[model samples]
Target: MRSSPVSRCRMHCYFETGSPMCGGGTRTVFSKRRAGSGVLSPVREGSTLTHGAQKGSISNYEVYLGALVGTLLGAAPAVLADNPIIQTLYSTDPAPYVWNDTVWLFTGHDEPNSDWFTMKDWRLFSSTDMVNWRDWGKMMSVETFSWASADAWAGQVIERNGKFYYYVPVTRKGSSMGIGVGVSDSITGPYKDAIGAPLVANSAIDPTVWIDDDGQAYLYWGNPNLYYIKLNEDMISYSGGINTVDLSSFQGHFEEAPWLYKRDSTYYLAYAGHCCSEDLRYSTAPGPTGPWTYRGQVMPTQGSSFTNHPGIIDYKDGSYLFYHNGALPGGGGFTRSVAVEKFEYGSDGSIPTMDMTTEGAPQIAPLDPYARVEAETIAFSSGLSTEPSSDGGGIHVTSISNGDYIKVKGVGFGDSGAASVSLRVAAANGGAKVELRLGSRTGAVIASCSVDATGGADVWKTISCPLSGSATGQQDLFFNFVGGGDQNLFKFNWWQFARK
Candidate 1:
């Protein structure tokens, strides 16, 4: 379980009508700083954004605000509303990893509204709360593997010995499919090919890695057939020879995409069963390489996609299954999106069948609006797309049009409420406004900031807007774009709130 960081709190008086009372107490707020830094400005006397508790000057409002902020200081609500967890792009072959208290999601990107499996590179996203995922564009690509020409397919990542290893399927130039590995010190990586050659050149796909309790690592991948190799501590290499799992003892039909994991003393292997329109099924074994027994379906064939892939993990005392489906607006077999569902194992250790849902996974924690949050960190959005930031650091929300909006769930503005908001944006065609709304896209407007041309779409600037009109308590925050033009309004990078 993750603990909440100590927050810099303030006091404010509110009327029964829910408007700020103002003038009764000394209002204190904090200056904008990078989110998650845990550093606050030194408290000064009579400052609007002061920090720490004010002794003897406490009032009922102060007590109420203090207690309210304290009670809600921990995890916030989820920002997600439905399936296809990410709406910015078509993300498929979901691979989620938990490290350093965060879930790092790696997926293959499908070309916009393509007809085939047109994948070029792999993408990355991270989240503390399951709903609002932050986009980290293009972790590694076919370009990352020099010898590989095309097909950046399904893969999995595992962390070992302070190094992160990514095992993925790629096609070596003129040759068959091979499993390639990349390594980096950071989970959000500038990963390089660990070995310039393919780790396993077996003409197979969908690689999943598992590190056992005894510290032995295993790599599993294939379609129509299942294969595994005992990986050395280095992870880039394997010991002994490649081994195959016999399918005769399997109960259900097996097509491809095998995910191996162990819970308690039982080993589980979940895979896509049957081709054309595949269903998610699994089997169990006592060890990593099993004389396996096929279990029933994990998920029956559903969604718009003709194929499905599964990635499962136990996070925050909950079991989550990550998979992809053709459920987006232009989604199909080629244009797929990732979605997750929270599930529990049966008392006998069998996975109960689950249905694909738009609600996705429930928010395990609430989002802190007082902290700096990336524009790409979204729960639900419409009429927008994301791209590599103009500043070249990370991704920013882009392709935004008038009337398009982004929704962030469970924003804890606290009882004191927000005083102002800061936005980092860039505009090629200027004259756009960001309307900060509460509850819904058409909800109560708390603030709006005008955006002017920044010379180019990539040229960046920061703007601030003063907030007002009952923006208190924990509520869903929406960034509604309003502008006039056929072109995009502006590119958004990040946003932060100053406490009232």
Candidate 2:
């Protein structure tokens, strides 16, 4: 059967009014574009990395909001994220590719290892914020037509020149099964195969294309002979034709699905070894096709369709891994759901470390709810590097940044003037407003609605003016701060780490 194609945000734009872009006085939002829309304001300086507190490489960090900022005016604190940038998508075999701020996940909506492609269908889901998602519904199915039918497996989606192409893997009744090519002008569409036949049929089951520097592209696929074929400018087929290699050097066992990409000059090939069952063991190689060296196990979630089929993509100067895992919380169906994690590259450029957490890690938080709704928990920078700053007399803030959860506890407050000490913040540039919590040292947040910003993306936010600290010392605060506009650079405020 033919297959289909599939397809963050910067921190820093959360403060409103008096932006440096606006010359630090007063300006409304009409003068600016909304956050995460990929629109950016001309930078107005003030975006340097200022480190006031740092002894060494910092470890971990936290952010929290309790009910205490106001007595008469109380509101709920915003939620923090944990790990696994994206916990799940509608289907598995998740192959994610980034386009603009949106993350496109093309996956198969069928049962895991079902050996049934006839019943299988493919779908596409999109996310602008990586937190909230927009599902386009069932995209293509074996039942969709007559030319192709059944056993849809692992394939890839790539855009070249102008159009999008979907390379689908399937098991034709008589033919052993290879990748068939499909075409669509839009990422989400009712696509039709290119040559009305598989692009490189019978080459390998799982096919993925990696476009390298020098305008050259290579196809990575298969089992015994991990294969490759340079793609033409059209990206419809191979330029130098399909090339196959023996993946013996690398410890690829039962290896099938393959995903490859190049970073700097290093080409990375990540594939699954062993059967993709619940006890699935994942491994990777350094080069696209080579003495593929074996790394440690990537996942062990079990084959409820909860296996590893990684699709690596680069966006906003960072790398992310898109794969699958068992969605059956009850541990039943081989239901595969798409998930993601931030990637860490090693010094020697050896094997990379992927940070996966039940909580969202490697992502900026207090994200726009309208954005892609990902996992709830987030991974924060750890260590006592800095604290939120505060007003000299009331509450003491030590360090501050975007999307951090700080813990506050040292001072006792009078419930009466909650509104006065309610903790307010505004960007040097005019943006938007929101309810910030200046929680009491007691429970969670009491009096709320204090701080507000535009949830600025990559563009950095400098807290030239901040809430004052309490007369008492050591006020506890959770760092849930965010920095940068989606397109700008992400930097934090001056952190008073452990003091001078």
lDDT of 2 by residue, 127-201 (tens): 544543334445566544344556667667878776787777765546566567777888786677676566666
Number of backbone collisions per candidate: 8, 131
Report residue 166 deviation for candidate 2 (angstroms).
1.1
Number of colliding residue pairs in model 2: 131
Compute the lDDT of residue 400 as modeled in candidate 1: 80
TM-score, one value per model: 0.83, 0.53
Q: Residue pairs in steric clash, candidate 1?
A: 29-48, 29-49, 75-366, 76-365, 76-366, 77-366, 82-358, 83-358
Shift in Å, residue 300, candidate 1: 0.7
**What lDDT, from 0 to 1, does candidate 1 have?**
0.75
lDDT of 1 by residue, 167-243 (tens): 98888899888889999998889889999999999786889899999999999887767789999999999899999
- Over 4 Å off in model 1, which ranges? 1-81
- Strongest candidate by TM-score: 1
